[model samples]
Target: MDPTHSTLLHRLLDATTWRAFDVDAEGRILAGHDASGSVQLVELRPDGARVPLTALPGAVSGRYVPGSRRVVVSHDAGGNERAQLSLLDPDAVTAPLGEDELTPLVRDPDHIHGLVEVLPTGEVVYTTNRRNGVDFDLVVHRLADGTETVLYDGGGMVGGATVSHEGTRALMTRPGRPALSSQVLLLVGDTTTELTDAGEHARYGGLEWLPGGETAIVTSDSGRDHLGVAALDVATGHLTWLVTDDAHDVTARLSPDGRRLLVVTDDDGASRLAIHDADGTFLRDVALPAELRAGVADFLTLPRWSPDGTGLAITWTDPATPADVLLVDAERGRAGVVASSREPLADLDLVDPTSHGVPTPDGETVPCFVYAPPEPSGSSVVIVHGGPEGQSVRSFSAVVQALVGDGHTVLVPNVRGSVGYGKRWYSLDDVERRLDSVADLAALHTHLPRLGLDPARSALWGGSYGGYMVLAGLAFQPQLWAAGVDIVGISSLVTFLENTSPYRRAHREREYGSLERDREFLERASPLNRIGDVRAPLFVIHGANDPRVPLSEAEQVAAAVRANGVEVEMVVYDDEGHGLAKRANRLDAYPRAVAFLGRALA
Candidate 1:
């Protein structure tokens, strides 16, 4: 690796990202940070002290049982994402929980469990696909006695489940076939009722049970372009819109007393957080520190409100800084850093990203973030995001920043089928329409020269689905790109759907189409079939243990492209699952990737 690029990776890897998962009754924040290389759980005390809670080897995230000292932590082996629930006692002064002390609540090898919630009764409510291995069902687990009860076993994907404070009722969202459209179901003593008939193109999520347990607060896109907060009556299945906006509004956090809500609005990719009464009366926007105001503040975990409801905990990140956990006072809206992994970014000169909208031939607009080097390097790289359903948000990215530092312009585009936009925009590239996203990529390449970038020297890069896009671009429009980089990306849609983790097969097939119904379409969409058309040097990266995309995706693509006399470089990490999680692995892999791209583009 080049010394400059190696130094860039070193700096980027040094800054650890922290994610605050939950807050305990005593106001201590449970956060996951990469201070030890692999992400581990740590407790952030109010007095600015950090306590290591878990010393596990994989990514672990947990939440405290409302009134107990025990925390329920979820861990996945490698990155296969078949997460299992484990109980840990943070108060125990012993050197982290030993393997014998760690108690596994739901440990099924072939199944996956997630979205855990602790009911007031001390029963853990979580979603699992253990029944049929495809669709998820809600399960209530009694941690005290190791008893499990299937709460709701209905079909489709159980997006999430939330139990009421009294444990008498629960809410489960079943996302419809088209993807974003969903139906919210109310669960009462052995009976489930549909609370909202959110039809096609409408999305519903962020379910929270309000006081008295008769009503709940949820964010829905019914009868609107963007998601807005609304209250649903459990008895009547009626919705009363409270906070409607042009931008997507989501319920971030609710106070302990259930009197206040922290609503987060996704204005494109940047986040705007505001506090509101449970009845939807707007109070004021939560003022963020200057650093956090520049980029995205992730509210996915739901803000952790102090047990007393006087303070909230949040995670924030930007182009320059990795994620940091902060504690904010509820009354004055003042925020102070609780835990930050900022050592890695101490003195690095980082580039600030400028947002742009590129127009496609079909009259659709794709959003992109451009990070340019100080000195114009005619060469450019287009980094496609994974999740034909995922959007390119304003988050810190080490690879993008490093590429820009290496004198290459980086363009991260949120193409047609990305979220953060409305439901219609999100479904634009589903299944048969996926190639339309490839066209959007071509259009972005055409528009790059306008930003003083060289169209002839541009490279296409992405991971997972984005990796598929890189291969597709190289094959479909061979003349357009100078090189390509695919990280744990799909080479064949049919093979990917067939070989992906069984638990995720149904959900993924919903997005990419199934082999039984859309075999021909899947074949036509796969880049493997068109590999002969690729002319540029290709670099492939994959984790041997990846359960999502699988290593074969990279191996097959590299072998096929190499057979066509294309210069192909392959790197596979034996211990990694999906993506590189350990800092050492990242430091080893990323610089080589930069070196490969640097040599190819040069």
Candidate 2:
């Protein structure tokens, strides 16, 4: 590995990727590009020209207003995730847009106003916890009159709302009592009706209303372990299974014309796309490029359908390639790059991962993607994904590539409690069973030899919940790992639940176990509690203003481990939260961490 972290990691970080979010009527694509150091909204013109929509320190996402010429942009402060909604008129902005060009629609730094959908009637449906700071209420804001109305105050965190085509009604989601599940609600003329059965705790999302609004298409795990697309009747609340995969989860979206359905299957971690009729009749599959997965910048959601419905603008990428939006011809059944986010990194050899399933001691299989370097580096890094419910898929990761390029093998594991496999797999390590997922780390190390990696020379790396896994791995199974890098991870579950934002406490308690009822278990499961057991060198990275895990989580863990006479390096970014958003900070931070890894592993 290069002695200087800047040389190797600098070039790797320099390679940027653009993601297409929404396409306007004139074929101008609204995308998030990192060419300007931070991810900002850009308008990709038809004639190869580009217009910058926002210049901010944090990343921004926008969607074209259904019936208006303006776009609705969602921006946040420092990565606090307290989203503020604004309207941006492309014509009104200069070549490089300033903050003043955006007209604030919902501005409250203290509260979160997340963008849900923009109705054709020039109204925006969003969810905000401003009502009480504990429960999020669905709100409708009219751009014309600047009138705001509380759509639904469900007494809990209202997950998301999808407005109807005519804009008279909306479908909302409320987090269910069970983890990885949600309750669907239909709101029409001030009346909200429950759609899914309350008894059955199943995950429901990607709700799209049919032409007449009688039947809606949704992706759910209602009666099955795997997520599948189903036709939901609003009146009767009966669901007719449209497409189901025995192994992997699948999501579907209704095409604009309402004649075809675009079904995307999560085959392992990669994606496969297929077209189906409205009735679930199988149509021809859209062949994607080898090794590439079909998705938008937002990995979970399906690609955006063109306004005419004759084509689709989809984002495609693999472990080796950056994301680029491709246009798929619905009739011709072919794909071509319409808006390219591919950078000038073709000269660099980006490593691709091969899928593998490691068997755990408890007869469960942990899905992982192994990225092996061309040359043997002796040491390996296991990157754990956050969400505990989030799955590590085969996608382009600069960090993974940089580490592999530096000659260290990287293993991304989707242990128990990760989505995309099935509901059963994600529920394996819930609440009292949380440590079972951490045990999967030792299981992964035990099976490392099968993949020609040494367990003794391994390290753990992750952020958020994954960060917790890293700390847990180093503390609980101290002998297995050589080093650990925890980014905004929870050191103590007890503190995490107590210090987390009020709006998120109850919702997160559903997965991590309640602070009131399970305080003892939370303390026992906390890595900070077991810091005395840790022997490996550690590197802690955190944002000072992080509202999720809180900076104290990082501080206490670092202080505890350092007091034990073990080497601990802590890096805190003052202007960030949860994760580093700016490329300048990333260039400094990631390289330093990698440099630390090199020394610790050596």
Candidate 3:
């Protein structure tokens, strides 16, 4: 399942996902909980593998305790605003690690936010508290005696803890200045040794120690485009990149034989997996596509390959298709769909093929898709998704359905840089031509009227980076529509990155350009600098407590656009972060957006 194209369900369910993955002392599959509280970790067939958690309760986070075979899972109970975390034994039966029993005692009026690791000698839980606009330090607990410890303080982000094969060294991420371009540190017995230096915002976050603890594998960047594996000398602190010049990302697993590496990446905008010699050279290419590129929260997850590195499996689905798994030959990259999650969904009835494409300024062609309930006399809305990295899928979308239900036609134009396209297409979305996507967006609107779509009924809406695009479209082409929605989107690239968390400090360098280093470039690409030119009935949505694209971002435009008396409306949700995760926020928001777009563009 190479993702050169896709189905719809991929958009429906992929907001973010988590599955409980557990392995035994010998590194074999023990149990997996897609949801929790089923017969847990019952090792039924193999010595290293435990039984699967057949009945999952739609958990969002989980962890496997060491020494023991128990796994803990977390979920936000429906109708309840709080989160619940519970422990599950191998039989899929669960036991709550109540405050009295669980380490890193859950916060009152709040819940735990750590991955539990049960080691042979102790139970370790990693959680954090914030300070000075940053995730200060992580608090760790040793459950063997219910004793708590602060392993790494606010100066760094500590995670991906791996005990050496000998259980002597614990390697984890140590965030450095200017954000996520962090280093890997090893706490051996008593000494804290640094294995990497803070480089461009790339992180040495994902780490795996060699079986013998002689070396470690970490991830960093090459040419500001992709993440690659780096082999490090645990004893000397020396490191080197494993791949070059191809937008690749990796999670390397040391082979049981101690002489091979299993890696995954979408090096060509097409999924790929490879096995390399212990020395960082390619030995074999593995078959994996969708899973290798699936987004979980803000980053991509690398599926766990078989212990022997002989085979691999992953899951993927899109709007017009059902979820399914892919299994393949690890060395040769030969692959095939192994299973479907459910019966295939009925395909959608697409209309007027002529309405499906947008022409870019450079004359490149892009595809656009529109869906609307039968509305003979109503307005239409054009939507751009965040992550110029994202594309509108053929599947069901909560927002899309809500808009259509309210008599609004929704259009998704995959202006270049959206995945599922080739490398050149995706790269075209880089900094200098940032507005090209918005330009293509306008072409779609112009193309619509020719297809019997009313231009007077059209408007634009998007969130995050897409929201930035929405604002950009209206700023640069004020006559495109009648209204727009900008949700927690960036008003200025320069300031957005300047105050953003370290996690994205490095990304801006490649995505747009550095604020301190490339001030002019950043300014040129941002819409805030040009907000004075925006003309529309703008309703801005923002999370006052947002840590990604901060609330100030929306406020800047709200203040500026309103000062100009452009009919700008701004709404803020303080409890929300980068998005409206709380139910009340969503319920109130959906109706408000419909009303706003309806009244203005109506």
Candidate that scores best on lDDT: 2
Clashes of each: 2, 0, 33
| Alpha carbon lDDT of each predicted model | 0.82, 0.83, 0.57
Model 3 C-alpha lDDT per residue in residues 1-602, reported as the tens digit of each score: 11211223232223322221433443444322221322122232334233444242222344456556565554433212233444555553354333233322344324324453444455554544333323434445555566765555535345566666655567777554432246677776556777666554445546677656777777655234456677777888776776543544455655544567666564322334567786778876654444222221112223444555565444443332233344445567665544432233233332221135666557888767666556634568888877766755544344665565555677777777675444456667676767776678777777766556788778888888888988887787887778889988988888898877564555445666567677887787788888788778898888765666877889888898888789987788766666665445655665566678867865
Model 1 clashes, total count: 2
- Deviation of model 2 at 253, angstroms: 1.8
**Candidate 2, clashing residue pairs?**
none
Candidate 2 global lDDT: 0.83
Model 3, position 559, has a per-residue lDDT of 91
- The candidates, ranked best first by TM-score, are 2, 1, 3
**Which of 1 and 3 is ahead in TM-score?**
1
Compared with the true structure, what per-residue lDDT tens digits does model 1 show for residues 100-217?
4677777886678885687657799888887888778898888778888787887766887788886767898887666557888988878988876645567788888888888888
Residue 271 in candidate 2 has what lDDT?
Answer: 75
Q: Least lDDT summed over 10 consecutive residues: which range in candidate 1? A: 93-102
lDDT for residue 505 in candidate 1, whole number 0-100 = 79
* Candidate numbers sorted by lDDT from highest down: 2, 1, 3
TM-score of each: 0.96, 0.96, 0.63
